[model samples]
Target chain A: MAVAEIKIELKKGVADPEGQNTKKALELLGFEGLRSVRSMKCFQVDIGLEGDEALKACQDMCRRLLANPVIQSYSVELK
Target chain B: MAVAEIKIELKKGVADPEGQNTKKALELLGFEGLRSVRSMKCFQVDIGLEGDEALKACQDMCRRLLANPVIQSYSVELK
Candidate 1:
């Protein structure tokens, strides 16, 4: 068995409200010097395949449902 | 500037509804041979510090607000 570690993140130039809010909250909490904050979602899935097969499956999954291709980019690593 | 890659994930035994739903949805989408799915939140923060100082700051952020000490665990990587 292998674990497909997938990460989905917004493309550059996209606005990240969640990250912005978090940064604002941190500043309010007295943590300064924060330039920017960007957020990503990660999914770890255990699959029955290994090596290239697992990686391929995960990429397909990301394209199908895990990521928004229009505004987000995804990376998959099988281990 | 340095980027602090922060990851927040549920601790062992904590139920992850998001992961469960994704797995179920994938199965419905005809994805077979899947065993399990786990989800994590990642934050990329640009800080004015570097190396150990940056790593320490991110840890402090996680302790103060980014992570829920009770049910979630966090990791910080400086790059």
Candidate 2:
């Protein structure tokens, strides 16, 4: 078995309200020196199969549903 | 300046409906060999301040808002 870790984040130039809000909140909470904050989603998948087949399936999944290629970028790590 | 990456995930034994649904979605989409799926949130904060002060502030944020200590676990990475 293998585990595929997928990280999805907004592409550069895209505005992230959640990240902005968090930064504001941090400042309000007295946390200083914050330049910016960005947020992303991560998925950890456990695959019953290993090797190339699993990797391909995961890549397909990412392309089809896990990420929006137009607005987000993703990276996959298999272990 | 520094960048702080925070990863938050559900604690062991906690139920994750989103993950389960995603796993089901992958199977329905014909991606085989999926045993399970788990999801988490990742935050990337850019800090103008470096060293221990920034780290301490981040830790406090995690404890107070970024994560629910009772149900989730979080890790911080500084770069």
* Model 2 lDDT per residue over B3-79, tens place: 88889999999999999999999889887767789999999988786889778878898998789999999988899
> What is candidate 2's CA lDDT for residue A16?
94
> What are the per-residue Cα lDDT tens digits for candidate 1 across A1-79?
8998899999998888999999999899888899998989999999899899889889999999999998999999877
Candidate 2, residue A77: how far the Cα is off, in Å: 1.6
For model 1, residues B17-75, the per-residue Cα lDDT tens digits are 99999999999988899999999999999988889989998999999999999999999
Worst 10 residues of 2 chain B by lDDT: B48-57
- Kindly list the per-residue Cα lDDT of model 2 for residues A1-79, writing each as its tens digit: 8898889999999999999998888888878778899999999999886878778777888899999999999988889
**Model 1 regions more than 4 Å off:** none
Clashing pairs in 1: none
Q: Residue A37: error of model 2 in Å?
A: 0.6
User: What i-RMS does each candidate reach, in Å?
Assistant: 1.0, 1.4
True-structure RMSD for candidate 2: 1.6
